[model samples]
Target: MQRKEALDILHSKLKKKNLVKHSLACEIGMKRIAEYLGEDADLWGLAGLLHDIDYEEIEDAEEHGKKGASFLKGKLDDKVVKAIERHTGYIEPKSTMDIALYALDPLTGLIIAAMLMHPSKTLAEIDTKFVLKKFKQKGFARGANREQILACEKISIPLDDFVNIVLKAMQEINEELTG
Candidate 1:
């Protein structure tokens, strides 16, 4: 399916504004990573955008990816479905796209959390150094899995570079995400 259709599905399922913003932030991160890796940006963006489609609906946290994939089975490509399913890290990420989603998903949350902690509370005021420092702190954004974010290393992208790329991507869409 196209981006617009995928977004419509996301909006229909996720009622909370924060959830939508998170998905959009992930989409920006995915698109940036896909570009850097010479992959399909649109497809990667869609996978990131819809990865949490069932988060609010699924009672069990583990079922979020599986059920979301099931919900979008016919509408999205099988690879996209599998990426969405594997994004939660319950399933091993086997493909580049899968790994990208897995790595990008939580990092978006971490980036946002890091930005919020900044005195300015804006993307422009935040930088890679700040985010990397926060990444190392055990008590910071505890919910954003550090291991999952480190998945970028499997693709040979250094943690610092990955964090910078994601941070810049989110910054480009700062208004839509934070406003």
Candidate 2:
């Protein structure tokens, strides 16, 4: 399916505003990482954008990735579905692209949390150090899933570096993100 079609499907399936925002953040984050790594940005963005398409249908955290992969069986390509499937951190990310998605899947939520807590209440106002500190805090966005963010190390990029890269990209598109 086309990107817009996929987005429409995602929007229809996701009801929570915060969830939708997180999906978009992942999309943008993955897209930037893909560009940095000389991969297909569109494909990466779509993978990130549709990663949680089945979250509502599969409430069990253990089965969410598998369910999402199955849900996109005939809707998207195999690679895209694989990206969604492995995004949950249940399995080790085997590719740079997979690592990118895994890293940002939870990092995006943490960044958003940091942005919301900032005085400016914007992505641009979020500092990399602040986000890194938040990552170490057990009480800050507890569900941000540090395990997934730590997967960034598999790609040779430390967690702080990964967060900075994603946050910078998001800052450039903050208007589109928060608008």
Estimated TM-score per prediction?
A: 0.98, 0.90
Best by TM-score: 1
TM-score of 1: 0.98
Scored by CA lDDT, what does every candidate get?
Answer: 0.92, 0.83
User: Deviation in angstroms for 51 in model 2?
Assistant: 0.4
Model 2: CA > 4 A from native: none
Model 1 misplacement above 4 A: none
Alpha carbon lDDT at 153, candidate 2: 85
The model with the greatest lDDT is 1
C-alpha lDDT of candidate 2 relative to the true structure: 0.83
lDDT, candidate 1, equals 0.92
Candidate 1: tens digits of C-alpha lDDT, residues 1-179: 89889889999999999999999999989999999999889998999899999999898877879999998898888999999999988889999899989998889999889989999999888999999999999999999999999999998889999999999999999899999
lDDT of 2 by residue, 153-173 (tens): 887787777888899988877
Q: How many clashes show up in model 1?
A: 0
